[model samples]
Target: MMKVKEFMITDVVTVTKETSIKRLLEILVTNKIGGVPVVDAENKLQGMITDGDVIRYLQPKGRTVYDMFTLILVSEKEDLQHKLEYAIDHHVDKIMRKKEIFTVNPNDDLEAATSIFSKYRFKKIPVVDDSNKVSGVISRGDVIRYISTKLISDK
Candidate 1:
Protein backbone atom coordinates (compact mmCIF):
# COMPACT_ATOMS: atom_id res chain seq x y z
CA MET A 1 0.00 0.00 0.00
CA MET A 2 1.34 3.43 -0.90
CA LYS A 3 1.86 5.72 2.04
CA VAL A 4 1.47 9.47 2.29
CA LYS A 5 5.22 9.85 2.75
CA GLU A 6 5.77 8.45 -0.69
CA PHE A 7 3.48 10.87 -2.41
CA MET A 8 3.42 14.05 -0.36
CA ILE A 9 5.38 17.07 -1.52
CA THR A 10 8.13 17.63 1.00
CA ASP A 11 8.95 21.14 -0.12
CA VAL A 12 5.83 22.53 1.41
CA VAL A 13 5.13 26.25 1.29
CA THR A 14 4.23 27.56 4.73
CA VAL A 15 3.61 30.79 6.60
CA THR A 16 3.73 32.01 10.15
CA LYS A 17 0.72 33.53 11.87
CA GLU A 18 2.36 36.93 11.84
CA THR A 19 2.81 36.80 8.08
CA SER A 20 1.06 39.75 6.44
CA ILE A 21 -2.05 39.07 4.40
CA LYS A 22 -0.51 40.95 1.49
CA ARG A 23 2.52 38.68 1.54
CA LEU A 24 0.31 35.62 1.77
CA LEU A 25 -1.61 36.68 -1.29
CA GLU A 26 1.63 37.16 -3.19
CA ILE A 27 2.83 33.72 -2.14
CA LEU A 28 -0.38 32.09 -3.34
CA VAL A 29 -0.32 33.83 -6.69
CA THR A 30 3.38 33.24 -7.30
CA ASN A 31 3.20 29.60 -6.28
CA LYS A 32 -0.07 29.01 -8.05
CA ILE A 33 -1.31 27.14 -4.99
CA GLY A 34 -4.79 27.37 -3.56
CA GLY A 35 -3.65 27.43 0.08
CA VAL A 36 -0.76 27.08 2.51
CA PRO A 37 -0.33 25.62 5.95
CA VAL A 38 0.17 28.07 8.78
CA VAL A 39 3.08 27.11 11.00
CA ASP A 40 5.03 28.44 13.90
CA ALA A 41 8.72 29.20 14.38
CA GLU A 42 9.35 25.52 14.96
CA ASN A 43 7.23 24.50 11.99
CA LYS A 44 4.37 23.15 14.08
CA LEU A 45 1.11 23.25 12.23
CA GLN A 46 -1.17 25.93 13.67
CA GLY A 47 -3.82 26.49 11.00
CA MET A 48 -4.59 26.84 7.33
CA ILE A 49 -5.35 29.66 4.90
CA THR A 50 -6.69 29.55 1.39
CA ASP A 51 -7.22 31.91 -1.50
CA GLY A 52 -10.94 31.48 -0.90
CA ASP A 53 -10.58 32.85 2.59
CA VAL A 54 -8.80 35.94 1.29
CA ILE A 55 -11.43 36.46 -1.38
CA ARG A 56 -14.22 36.18 1.14
CA TYR A 57 -12.47 38.62 3.42
CA LEU A 58 -12.09 41.16 0.65
CA GLN A 59 -15.61 40.76 -0.73
CA PRO A 60 -17.84 43.66 0.24
CA LYS A 61 -20.45 42.53 2.72
CA GLY A 62 -24.03 43.78 2.42
CA ARG A 63 -25.30 46.06 5.13
CA THR A 64 -27.90 44.73 7.53
CA VAL A 65 -31.44 46.07 7.50
CA TYR A 66 -34.00 45.94 10.26
CA ASP A 67 -37.63 46.96 9.81
CA MET A 68 -40.74 46.96 11.97
CA PHE A 69 -44.28 48.23 11.60
CA THR A 70 -43.19 51.86 11.79
CA LEU A 71 -39.40 51.68 12.25
CA ILE A 72 -36.73 50.96 9.70
CA LEU A 73 -32.97 50.76 10.17
CA VAL A 74 -30.31 50.57 7.51
CA SER A 75 -26.56 50.77 7.43
CA GLU A 76 -24.60 53.02 5.11
CA LYS A 77 -22.41 51.62 2.38
CA GLU A 78 -18.97 50.64 3.60
CA ASP A 79 -15.90 52.30 2.11
CA LEU A 80 -14.18 49.81 -0.18
CA GLN A 81 -10.75 51.42 0.11
CA HIS A 82 -10.85 51.31 3.87
CA LYS A 83 -11.84 47.67 3.92
CA LEU A 84 -9.16 46.71 1.43
CA GLU A 85 -6.48 48.56 3.36
CA TYR A 86 -7.52 46.89 6.62
CA ALA A 87 -7.58 43.40 5.12
CA ILE A 88 -4.24 43.77 3.38
CA ASP A 89 -2.51 45.00 6.52
CA HIS A 90 -3.93 42.36 8.83
CA HIS A 91 -1.96 39.23 9.78
CA VAL A 92 -2.86 35.74 8.73
CA ASP A 93 -3.70 34.77 12.31
CA LYS A 94 -6.53 37.27 12.23
CA ILE A 95 -8.25 35.47 9.37
CA MET A 96 -6.72 32.00 9.13
CA ARG A 97 -8.90 28.99 9.87
CA LYS A 98 -7.46 27.86 13.17
CA LYS A 99 -10.16 25.59 14.48
CA GLU A 100 -10.89 22.08 13.28
CA ILE A 101 -7.89 21.61 11.05
CA PHE A 102 -7.79 18.32 9.13
CA THR A 103 -4.29 16.79 9.01
CA VAL A 104 -2.67 13.46 8.17
CA ASN A 105 0.54 11.81 9.27
CA PRO A 106 3.39 10.95 6.96
CA ASN A 107 3.16 7.25 7.73
CA ASP A 108 -0.57 7.10 7.19
CA ASP A 109 -2.00 5.18 4.27
CA LEU A 110 -2.76 7.06 1.09
CA GLU A 111 -6.33 5.88 1.33
CA ALA A 112 -6.71 7.72 4.62
CA ALA A 113 -5.65 11.00 3.06
CA THR A 114 -7.92 10.47 0.07
CA SER A 115 -10.85 9.68 2.32
CA ILE A 116 -10.36 12.90 4.29
CA PHE A 117 -10.14 14.95 1.11
CA SER A 118 -13.26 13.29 -0.29
CA LYS A 119 -15.26 13.73 2.89
CA TYR A 120 -14.25 17.26 3.70
CA ARG A 121 -13.75 18.59 0.17
CA PHE A 122 -10.28 19.79 1.15
CA LYS A 123 -7.99 20.58 -1.73
CA LYS A 124 -4.87 19.90 0.31
CA ILE A 125 -3.94 18.08 3.50
CA PRO A 126 -0.86 18.83 5.58
CA VAL A 127 1.24 15.83 6.43
CA VAL A 128 2.47 16.05 9.98
CA ASP A 129 4.73 14.05 12.23
CA ASP A 130 3.85 12.63 15.65
CA SER A 131 4.85 15.96 17.17
CA ASN A 132 2.31 17.71 14.87
CA LYS A 133 5.04 19.37 12.86
CA VAL A 134 4.38 19.75 9.18
CA SER A 135 6.57 17.44 7.13
CA GLY A 136 4.89 17.71 3.77
CA VAL A 137 1.63 18.37 1.97
CA ILE A 138 -0.56 16.29 -0.30
CA SER A 139 -3.11 17.77 -2.65
CA ARG A 140 -5.84 16.36 -4.86
CA GLY A 141 -3.61 16.95 -7.84
CA ASP A 142 -0.87 14.89 -6.26
CA VAL A 143 -3.20 11.95 -5.77
CA ILE A 144 -4.51 12.14 -9.30
CA ARG A 145 -1.03 12.27 -10.75
CA TYR A 146 0.13 9.35 -8.60
CA ILE A 147 -2.80 7.22 -9.64
CA SER A 148 -2.43 8.01 -13.29
CA THR A 149 1.28 7.27 -13.39
CA LYS A 150 1.61 4.43 -10.86
CA LEU A 151 -1.73 2.65 -10.87
CA ILE A 152 -2.70 2.86 -14.52
CA SER A 153 -0.05 2.28 -17.09
CA ASP A 154 -0.21 1.70 -20.82
CA LYS A 155 0.34 -2.00 -21.17
Candidate 2:
Protein backbone atom coordinates (compact mmCIF):
# COMPACT_ATOMS: atom_id res chain seq x y z
CA MET A 1 0.00 0.00 0.00
CA MET A 2 1.24 3.49 -0.73
CA LYS A 3 2.00 5.62 2.29
CA VAL A 4 0.86 9.14 2.94
CA LYS A 5 4.46 10.36 2.94
CA GLU A 6 4.78 9.28 -0.66
CA PHE A 7 2.32 11.94 -1.79
CA MET A 8 2.03 14.40 1.12
CA ILE A 9 3.43 17.89 0.63
CA THR A 10 6.46 18.38 2.84
CA ASP A 11 6.83 22.07 2.05
CA VAL A 12 3.73 23.05 4.01
CA VAL A 13 2.88 26.69 4.60
CA THR A 14 1.66 26.86 8.16
CA VAL A 15 0.62 29.61 10.51
CA THR A 16 0.68 30.09 14.25
CA LYS A 17 -2.35 30.80 16.41
CA GLU A 18 -1.22 34.35 16.70
CA THR A 19 -1.06 34.91 12.95
CA SER A 20 -3.25 37.84 11.86
CA ILE A 21 -6.16 37.39 9.49
CA LYS A 22 -4.44 39.67 7.00
CA ARG A 23 -1.31 37.55 7.05
CA LEU A 24 -3.30 34.37 6.60
CA LEU A 25 -5.03 35.82 3.56
CA GLU A 26 -1.69 36.79 2.06
CA ILE A 27 -0.29 33.31 2.60
CA LEU A 28 -3.32 31.61 1.09
CA VAL A 29 -3.31 33.86 -1.96
CA THR A 30 0.45 33.70 -2.48
CA ASN A 31 0.60 29.94 -2.09
CA LYS A 32 -2.60 29.41 -4.09
CA ILE A 33 -3.74 27.11 -1.35
CA GLY A 34 -7.25 26.66 0.02
CA GLY A 35 -6.16 26.21 3.61
CA VAL A 36 -3.31 25.51 6.03
CA PRO A 37 -2.73 23.75 9.28
CA VAL A 38 -2.13 25.90 12.30
CA VAL A 39 1.04 24.87 14.10
CA ASP A 40 3.17 26.07 16.95
CA ALA A 41 6.83 27.05 17.01
CA GLU A 42 7.64 23.40 17.67
CA ASN A 43 5.58 22.45 14.61
CA LYS A 44 2.88 20.64 16.56
CA LEU A 45 -0.50 20.65 14.90
CA GLN A 46 -2.91 23.00 16.66
CA GLY A 47 -5.78 23.52 14.26
CA MET A 48 -6.83 24.11 10.67
CA ILE A 49 -7.75 27.38 8.99
CA THR A 50 -9.23 27.78 5.55
CA ASP A 51 -10.30 30.51 3.19
CA GLY A 52 -13.91 29.46 3.84
CA ASP A 53 -13.39 30.02 7.55
CA VAL A 54 -12.01 33.46 6.85
CA ILE A 55 -14.98 34.32 4.70
CA ARG A 56 -17.46 33.16 7.30
CA TYR A 57 -15.67 35.01 10.05
CA LEU A 58 -15.37 38.16 8.03
CA GLN A 59 -18.97 38.10 6.86
CA PRO A 60 -20.92 40.97 8.34
CA LYS A 61 -23.63 40.05 10.77
CA GLY A 62 -27.05 40.36 9.29
CA ARG A 63 -29.25 43.19 10.43
CA THR A 64 -31.54 42.34 13.29
CA VAL A 65 -34.80 43.79 14.52
CA TYR A 66 -36.57 43.32 17.78
CA ASP A 67 -39.95 44.49 18.98
CA MET A 68 -41.12 44.56 22.58
CA PHE A 69 -44.74 45.70 22.66
CA THR A 70 -44.14 49.42 22.30
CA LEU A 71 -40.41 49.55 21.68
CA ILE A 72 -38.70 48.56 18.44
CA LEU A 73 -34.94 48.17 17.80
CA VAL A 74 -33.15 47.68 14.53
CA SER A 75 -29.49 47.22 13.61
CA GLU A 76 -28.23 48.37 10.25
CA LYS A 77 -26.34 45.99 8.01
CA GLU A 78 -22.55 46.36 8.02
CA ASP A 79 -20.60 46.75 4.83
CA LEU A 80 -18.16 43.97 3.99
CA GLN A 81 -15.27 46.38 3.58
CA HIS A 82 -16.02 48.01 6.91
CA LYS A 83 -16.07 44.65 8.65
CA LEU A 84 -12.82 43.58 6.98
CA GLU A 85 -11.09 46.74 8.14
CA TYR A 86 -11.74 45.80 11.74
CA ALA A 87 -11.15 42.09 11.32
CA ILE A 88 -7.81 42.32 9.53
CA ASP A 89 -5.93 42.63 12.83
CA HIS A 90 -7.76 39.80 14.56
CA HIS A 91 -5.73 36.64 15.30
CA VAL A 92 -6.51 33.38 13.56
CA ASP A 93 -7.26 31.52 16.78
CA LYS A 94 -10.59 33.27 16.94
CA ILE A 95 -11.68 31.68 13.69
CA MET A 96 -9.45 28.65 13.18
CA ARG A 97 -11.17 25.31 13.75
CA LYS A 98 -9.61 23.75 16.82
CA LYS A 99 -11.95 20.88 17.54
CA GLU A 100 -12.36 17.46 15.96
CA ILE A 101 -9.30 17.99 13.79
CA PHE A 102 -8.70 14.76 11.86
CA THR A 103 -5.07 13.98 11.01
CA VAL A 104 -3.11 11.21 9.33
CA ASN A 105 0.41 9.94 9.95
CA PRO A 106 3.09 9.65 7.30
CA ASN A 107 3.24 5.87 7.64
CA ASP A 108 -0.50 5.44 7.24
CA ASP A 109 -1.88 3.98 4.05
CA LEU A 110 -2.92 6.43 1.35
CA GLU A 111 -6.45 5.18 1.91
CA ALA A 112 -6.34 6.86 5.30
CA ALA A 113 -6.22 10.27 3.70
CA THR A 114 -8.83 9.39 1.10
CA SER A 115 -11.20 8.11 3.75
CA ILE A 116 -11.11 11.36 5.66
CA PHE A 117 -11.53 13.39 2.50
CA SER A 118 -14.48 11.34 1.37
CA LYS A 119 -16.16 11.37 4.75
CA TYR A 120 -15.59 14.94 5.80
CA ARG A 121 -15.08 16.64 2.45
CA PHE A 122 -12.11 18.45 3.90
CA LYS A 123 -9.85 20.20 1.45
CA LYS A 124 -6.71 19.02 3.24
CA ILE A 125 -5.47 17.05 6.21
CA PRO A 126 -2.30 17.50 8.21
CA VAL A 127 0.16 14.62 8.48
CA VAL A 128 1.65 14.35 11.95
CA ASP A 129 4.27 12.25 13.67
CA ASP A 130 3.83 10.05 16.73
CA SER A 131 4.68 13.08 18.84
CA ASN A 132 1.84 15.01 17.15
CA LYS A 133 4.30 17.25 15.33
CA VAL A 134 3.22 18.21 11.84
CA SER A 135 5.36 16.48 9.23
CA GLY A 136 3.42 17.21 6.06
CA VAL A 137 0.04 17.99 4.53
CA ILE A 138 -2.12 16.12 2.05
CA SER A 139 -4.71 17.79 -0.13
CA ARG A 140 -7.40 16.40 -2.39
CA GLY A 141 -5.46 17.69 -5.36
CA ASP A 142 -2.38 15.82 -4.20
CA VAL A 143 -4.27 12.57 -3.92
CA ILE A 144 -5.83 13.02 -7.36
CA ARG A 145 -2.48 13.83 -8.91
CA TYR A 146 -0.85 10.82 -7.27
CA ILE A 147 -3.61 8.52 -8.57
CA SER A 148 -3.29 9.88 -12.06
CA THR A 149 0.48 9.76 -12.21
CA LYS A 150 1.21 6.58 -10.23
CA LEU A 151 -1.83 4.35 -9.90
CA ILE A 152 -3.52 4.72 -13.27
CA SER A 153 -0.27 5.05 -15.19
CA ASP A 154 0.98 1.81 -13.62
CA LYS A 155 -2.02 -0.06 -15.08
Candidate 3:
Protein backbone atom coordinates (compact mmCIF):
# COMPACT_ATOMS: atom_id res chain seq x y z
CA MET A 1 0.00 0.00 0.00
CA MET A 2 2.17 2.81 -1.30
CA LYS A 3 1.29 6.43 -0.66
CA VAL A 4 1.21 9.20 -3.22
CA LYS A 5 4.11 10.95 -1.49
CA GLU A 6 6.34 7.97 -2.24
CA PHE A 7 6.06 8.39 -6.01
CA MET A 8 4.83 11.93 -6.67
CA ILE A 9 7.20 14.38 -8.34
CA THR A 10 8.17 16.98 -5.77
CA ASP A 11 9.85 19.25 -8.30
CA VAL A 12 6.58 20.23 -9.89
CA VAL A 13 6.19 22.83 -12.59
CA THR A 14 3.30 25.20 -12.04
CA VAL A 15 1.75 28.36 -13.45
CA THR A 16 -0.42 31.21 -12.32
CA LYS A 17 -3.72 32.42 -13.68
CA GLU A 18 -2.16 35.58 -15.01
CA THR A 19 0.33 33.64 -17.12
CA SER A 20 -0.02 34.48 -20.79
CA ILE A 21 -0.94 31.76 -23.23
CA LYS A 22 2.32 32.24 -25.09
CA ARG A 23 4.25 31.67 -21.90
CA LEU A 24 2.08 28.71 -21.07
CA LEU A 25 2.82 27.14 -24.41
CA GLU A 26 6.49 27.73 -23.93
CA ILE A 27 6.40 26.11 -20.51
CA LEU A 28 4.61 23.07 -21.81
CA VAL A 29 6.98 22.66 -24.75
CA THR A 30 10.08 23.33 -22.70
CA ASN A 31 9.08 20.93 -19.95
CA LYS A 32 7.82 18.30 -22.40
CA ILE A 33 4.66 17.90 -20.39
CA GLY A 34 1.04 17.89 -21.50
CA GLY A 35 -0.38 19.94 -18.61
CA VAL A 36 0.36 21.88 -15.41
CA PRO A 37 -1.52 22.92 -12.36
CA VAL A 38 -2.46 26.56 -11.94
CA VAL A 39 -1.66 27.93 -8.51
CA ASP A 40 -2.16 31.29 -6.86
CA ALA A 41 0.43 33.55 -5.26
CA GLU A 42 -0.07 31.66 -2.01
CA ASN A 43 0.56 28.39 -3.82
CA LYS A 44 -3.05 27.30 -3.56
CA LEU A 45 -4.40 25.20 -6.40
CA GLN A 46 -6.64 27.37 -8.57
CA GLY A 47 -7.17 25.34 -11.70
CA MET A 48 -5.51 23.23 -14.36
CA ILE A 49 -4.26 23.97 -17.88
CA THR A 50 -3.31 21.53 -20.59
CA ASP A 51 -2.27 21.51 -24.22
CA GLY A 52 -5.70 20.10 -25.06
CA ASP A 53 -7.35 23.15 -23.55
CA VAL A 54 -5.25 25.48 -25.66
CA ILE A 55 -5.99 23.47 -28.76
CA ARG A 56 -9.72 23.54 -28.03
CA TYR A 57 -9.61 27.27 -27.50
CA LEU A 58 -7.71 27.90 -30.68
CA GLN A 59 -9.92 25.72 -32.85
CA PRO A 60 -11.85 27.85 -35.31
CA LYS A 61 -15.56 28.22 -34.81
CA GLY A 62 -18.00 26.56 -37.18
CA ARG A 63 -18.66 28.54 -40.38
CA THR A 64 -22.03 28.74 -42.01
CA VAL A 65 -22.26 28.22 -45.84
CA TYR A 66 -25.42 29.81 -47.12
CA ASP A 67 -25.08 28.96 -50.83
CA MET A 68 -23.76 25.76 -52.36
CA PHE A 69 -23.01 27.31 -55.79
CA THR A 70 -20.51 29.89 -54.60
CA LEU A 71 -17.52 29.89 -56.95
CA ILE A 72 -15.10 32.17 -55.10
CA LEU A 73 -14.36 30.79 -51.63
CA VAL A 74 -12.99 33.72 -49.65
CA SER A 75 -10.99 32.63 -46.68
CA GLU A 76 -10.17 35.13 -43.93
CA LYS A 77 -6.62 34.04 -43.26
CA GLU A 78 -5.68 37.30 -41.57
CA ASP A 79 -8.74 37.05 -39.32
CA LEU A 80 -7.61 33.65 -38.11
CA GLN A 81 -4.10 34.90 -37.41
CA HIS A 82 -5.44 37.92 -35.57
CA LYS A 83 -7.66 35.70 -33.43
CA LEU A 84 -4.73 33.43 -32.56
CA GLU A 85 -2.55 36.36 -31.63
CA TYR A 86 -5.25 37.77 -29.41
CA ALA A 87 -5.78 34.43 -27.76
CA ILE A 88 -2.08 33.96 -27.09
CA ASP A 89 -1.80 37.39 -25.55
CA HIS A 90 -4.62 36.67 -23.15
CA HIS A 91 -4.05 35.20 -19.66
CA VAL A 92 -4.27 31.47 -18.91
CA ASP A 93 -7.24 31.94 -16.60
CA LYS A 94 -9.37 32.82 -19.60
CA ILE A 95 -9.15 29.28 -20.95
CA MET A 96 -8.04 27.10 -17.99
CA ARG A 97 -10.42 24.43 -16.72
CA LYS A 98 -11.54 25.45 -13.24
CA LYS A 99 -14.39 23.27 -12.12
CA GLU A 100 -14.42 19.61 -11.12
CA ILE A 101 -10.66 19.26 -10.95
CA PHE A 102 -9.49 15.86 -9.69
CA THR A 103 -6.70 15.96 -7.12
CA VAL A 104 -5.15 13.65 -4.52
CA ASN A 105 -3.59 14.09 -1.11
CA PRO A 106 0.02 13.20 -0.46
CA ASN A 107 -1.02 10.75 2.23
CA ASP A 108 -3.68 9.05 0.13
CA ASP A 109 -3.24 5.46 -1.00
CA LEU A 110 -1.72 4.94 -4.42
CA GLU A 111 -4.71 2.85 -5.45
CA ALA A 112 -6.96 5.87 -4.96
CA ALA A 113 -4.85 7.91 -7.32
CA THR A 114 -4.85 5.06 -9.82
CA SER A 115 -8.64 4.87 -9.72
CA ILE A 116 -9.00 8.56 -10.40
CA PHE A 117 -6.63 8.45 -13.33
CA SER A 118 -8.36 5.44 -14.82
CA LYS A 119 -11.84 6.91 -14.39
CA TYR A 120 -11.05 10.39 -15.68
CA ARG A 121 -8.36 9.56 -18.24
CA PHE A 122 -6.17 12.26 -16.73
CA LYS A 123 -2.51 12.43 -17.69
CA LYS A 124 -1.46 13.84 -14.32
CA ILE A 125 -2.90 14.62 -10.94
CA PRO A 126 -1.64 17.23 -8.52
CA VAL A 127 -0.87 16.18 -4.98
CA VAL A 128 -2.09 18.66 -2.40
CA ASP A 129 -1.58 19.06 1.32
CA ASP A 130 -4.27 19.40 3.93
CA SER A 131 -4.21 23.14 3.39
CA ASN A 132 -4.91 22.65 -0.32
CA LYS A 133 -1.37 23.56 -1.33
CA VAL A 134 0.23 21.68 -4.19
CA SER A 135 3.12 19.66 -2.86
CA GLY A 136 3.79 17.46 -5.87
CA VAL A 137 2.43 15.94 -9.04
CA ILE A 138 1.96 12.33 -10.10
CA SER A 139 1.71 11.19 -13.70
CA ARG A 140 0.59 7.96 -15.29
CA GLY A 141 4.15 7.36 -16.34
CA ASP A 142 5.28 7.46 -12.74
CA VAL A 143 2.74 4.86 -11.72
CA ILE A 144 3.60 2.58 -14.61
CA ARG A 145 7.30 2.77 -13.85
CA TYR A 146 6.69 1.97 -10.21
CA ILE A 147 4.57 -1.02 -11.08
CA SER A 148 7.10 -2.34 -13.56
CA THR A 149 9.99 -2.11 -11.14
CA LYS A 150 8.20 -3.12 -7.96
CA LEU A 151 5.19 -5.32 -8.68
CA ILE A 152 6.00 -7.23 -11.89
CA SER A 153 9.73 -7.70 -11.41
CA ASP A 154 11.27 -11.14 -12.00
CA LYS A 155 13.30 -11.45 -8.89
Candidate 4:
Protein backbone atom coordinates (compact mmCIF):
# COMPACT_ATOMS: atom_id res chain seq x y z
CA MET A 1 0.00 0.00 0.00
CA MET A 2 1.27 3.39 -0.94
CA LYS A 3 1.85 5.76 1.98
CA VAL A 4 1.71 9.50 2.42
CA LYS A 5 5.46 9.80 2.03
CA GLU A 6 5.20 8.48 -1.51
CA PHE A 7 3.21 11.57 -2.48
CA MET A 8 4.06 14.18 0.11
CA ILE A 9 6.16 17.24 -0.51
CA THR A 10 9.38 16.94 1.43
CA ASP A 11 10.40 20.55 0.92
CA VAL A 12 7.85 22.03 3.28
CA VAL A 13 7.68 25.69 4.14
CA THR A 14 7.09 26.45 7.80
CA VAL A 15 6.65 29.42 10.10
CA THR A 16 7.34 30.10 13.72
CA LYS A 17 5.03 31.56 16.35
CA GLU A 18 7.05 34.76 16.33
CA THR A 19 6.73 35.29 12.59
CA SER A 20 5.14 38.59 11.67
CA ILE A 21 1.86 38.45 9.79
CA LYS A 22 3.14 40.98 7.26
CA ARG A 23 6.18 38.84 6.51
CA LEU A 24 4.04 35.72 6.56
CA LEU A 25 1.88 37.20 3.87
CA GLU A 26 4.92 37.89 1.78
CA ILE A 27 6.12 34.30 2.16
CA LEU A 28 2.72 32.88 1.25
CA VAL A 29 2.38 35.05 -1.81
CA THR A 30 5.93 34.43 -2.93
CA ASN A 31 5.60 30.70 -2.51
CA LYS A 32 2.02 30.63 -3.81
CA ILE A 33 0.96 28.64 -0.79
CA GLY A 34 -2.33 28.70 1.07
CA GLY A 35 -1.19 27.58 4.51
CA VAL A 36 1.96 26.72 6.42
CA PRO A 37 2.69 24.58 9.43
CA VAL A 38 3.76 26.46 12.53
CA VAL A 39 6.87 25.01 14.11
CA ASP A 40 9.07 25.76 17.07
CA ALA A 41 12.87 26.02 17.09
CA GLU A 42 12.97 22.27 17.67
CA ASN A 43 10.94 21.65 14.49
CA LYS A 44 7.93 20.42 16.39
CA LEU A 45 4.55 21.29 14.96
CA GLN A 46 3.09 23.98 17.16
CA GLY A 47 0.06 24.80 15.02
CA MET A 48 -1.06 25.88 11.58
CA ILE A 49 -2.05 29.12 9.89
CA THR A 50 -4.04 29.63 6.74
CA ASP A 51 -5.01 32.38 4.32
CA GLY A 52 -8.44 32.37 5.90
CA ASP A 53 -6.84 33.34 9.19
CA VAL A 54 -5.12 36.24 7.50
CA ILE A 55 -8.36 37.45 5.92
CA ARG A 56 -10.25 37.09 9.19
CA TYR A 57 -7.51 38.94 11.04
CA LEU A 58 -7.53 41.72 8.45
CA GLN A 59 -11.31 42.27 8.27
CA PRO A 60 -12.17 45.82 9.27
CA LYS A 61 -13.83 46.23 12.61
CA GLY A 62 -17.46 47.39 12.79
CA ARG A 63 -19.85 47.82 9.86
CA THR A 64 -18.99 49.42 6.56
CA VAL A 65 -20.47 52.79 5.58
CA TYR A 66 -22.55 52.56 2.43
CA ASP A 67 -22.24 55.89 0.64
CA MET A 68 -25.48 56.78 -1.15
CA PHE A 69 -23.88 59.44 -3.32
CA THR A 70 -20.77 57.61 -4.58
CA LEU A 71 -22.17 54.13 -3.99
CA ILE A 72 -19.02 52.85 -2.41
CA LEU A 73 -17.95 51.08 0.77
CA VAL A 74 -16.37 53.80 2.84
CA SER A 75 -13.55 52.85 5.13
CA GLU A 76 -13.55 53.81 8.79
CA LYS A 77 -10.97 53.42 11.52
CA GLU A 78 -11.78 51.08 14.37
CA ASP A 79 -9.95 50.03 17.50
CA LEU A 80 -9.25 46.53 16.25
CA GLN A 81 -7.41 47.57 13.10
CA HIS A 82 -4.32 48.74 14.90
CA LYS A 83 -4.39 45.76 17.22
CA LEU A 84 -4.66 43.31 14.32
CA GLU A 85 -1.82 44.98 12.48
CA TYR A 86 0.28 44.96 15.60
CA ALA A 87 -0.48 41.31 16.27
CA ILE A 88 0.58 40.41 12.77
CA ASP A 89 3.90 42.22 12.94
CA HIS A 90 5.14 40.73 16.20
CA HIS A 91 4.34 36.96 16.06
CA VAL A 92 2.22 34.09 14.80
CA ASP A 93 1.03 33.07 18.26
CA LYS A 94 -1.77 35.62 18.11
CA ILE A 95 -3.26 34.44 14.80
CA MET A 96 -2.28 30.78 14.42
CA ARG A 97 -4.86 28.01 14.53
CA LYS A 98 -4.04 26.45 17.84
CA LYS A 99 -7.01 24.16 18.12
CA GLU A 100 -7.73 22.56 14.79
CA ILE A 101 -4.41 21.56 13.36
CA PHE A 102 -4.80 18.31 11.39
CA THR A 103 -1.75 16.13 10.96
CA VAL A 104 -1.09 12.71 9.39
CA ASN A 105 1.49 10.06 10.04
CA PRO A 106 4.13 9.54 7.39
CA ASN A 107 3.31 5.84 7.22
CA ASP A 108 -0.43 6.37 6.92
CA ASP A 109 -2.23 5.27 3.79
CA LEU A 110 -2.81 7.95 1.18
CA GLU A 111 -6.49 7.07 1.09
CA ALA A 112 -6.81 7.90 4.76
CA ALA A 113 -5.04 11.18 4.26
CA THR A 114 -7.31 11.91 1.31
CA SER A 115 -10.34 11.20 3.44
CA ILE A 116 -9.23 13.69 6.06
CA PHE A 117 -8.59 16.37 3.48
CA SER A 118 -11.92 15.68 1.83
CA LYS A 119 -13.82 15.87 5.11
CA TYR A 120 -12.24 19.15 6.14
CA ARG A 121 -11.53 20.53 2.72
CA PHE A 122 -8.14 21.47 4.06
CA LYS A 123 -5.54 23.00 1.79
CA LYS A 124 -2.64 21.23 3.48
CA ILE A 125 -1.84 18.55 6.02
CA PRO A 126 1.41 18.24 7.91
CA VAL A 127 3.03 14.83 7.57
CA VAL A 128 4.64 13.83 10.84
CA ASP A 129 6.80 10.92 11.97
CA ASP A 130 6.35 8.75 15.04
CA SER A 131 8.10 11.37 17.14
CA ASN A 132 5.57 13.99 15.96
CA LYS A 133 8.15 15.86 13.98
CA VAL A 134 6.97 17.16 10.65
CA SER A 135 8.56 15.33 7.76
CA GLY A 136 6.64 16.92 4.91
CA VAL A 137 3.42 18.60 3.79
CA ILE A 138 0.58 17.02 1.83
CA SER A 139 -1.53 19.53 -0.04
CA ARG A 140 -4.83 19.22 -1.82
CA GLY A 141 -3.15 19.98 -5.11
CA ASP A 142 -0.72 17.13 -4.62
CA VAL A 143 -3.53 14.74 -3.92
CA ILE A 144 -5.41 15.89 -6.98
CA ARG A 145 -2.40 15.44 -9.18
CA TYR A 146 -1.67 12.04 -7.78
CA ILE A 147 -5.21 10.87 -8.32
CA SER A 148 -5.30 12.19 -11.84
CA THR A 149 -2.02 10.71 -12.88
CA LYS A 150 -1.89 7.49 -10.91
CA LEU A 151 -5.56 6.60 -10.80
CA ILE A 152 -7.41 8.34 -13.58
CA SER A 153 -4.75 7.65 -16.14
CA ASP A 154 -4.88 3.98 -15.26
CA LYS A 155 -8.56 3.95 -16.13
TM-score head-to-head 2 vs 4, winner: 2
How many backbone clashes does every candidate have?
A: 0, 0, 0, 2
Better of 3 and 4 by lDDT: 3
Question: How does residue 149 of candidate 4 score in lDDT?
Answer: 93
RMSD vs true structure, all candidates: 3.9, 3.2, 3.3, 5.0
33-147: candidate 1 lDDT, tens digit per residue: 9999999999999999999888777776555545665444332235445577878979999889998799999899999999998999999999999999999999999999978
Q: Per-residue alpha-carbon lDDT of model 4 for 1-155, expressed as tens digits?
A: 88998989999999999898888888999999998999988889999999998888777665555676655544546546665656667677888898877899888998978888889888899998887788999988988898789887788
Model 2 stretches with alpha carbons more than 4 Å out? 64-78, 151-155
Which residue window of length 10 is worst by lDDT in model 1?
Answer: 70-79
Residue pairs in collision within model 2: none
- Give lDDT per model, in order: 0.89, 0.91, 0.91, 0.84
How should the candidates be ordered by lDDT, best one leading?
A: 2, 3, 1, 4
* TM-score head-to-head 3 vs 4, winner: 3
Report how far residue 118 has shifted in candidate 4, in Å: 1.5
- Flag clash pairs in model 3: none
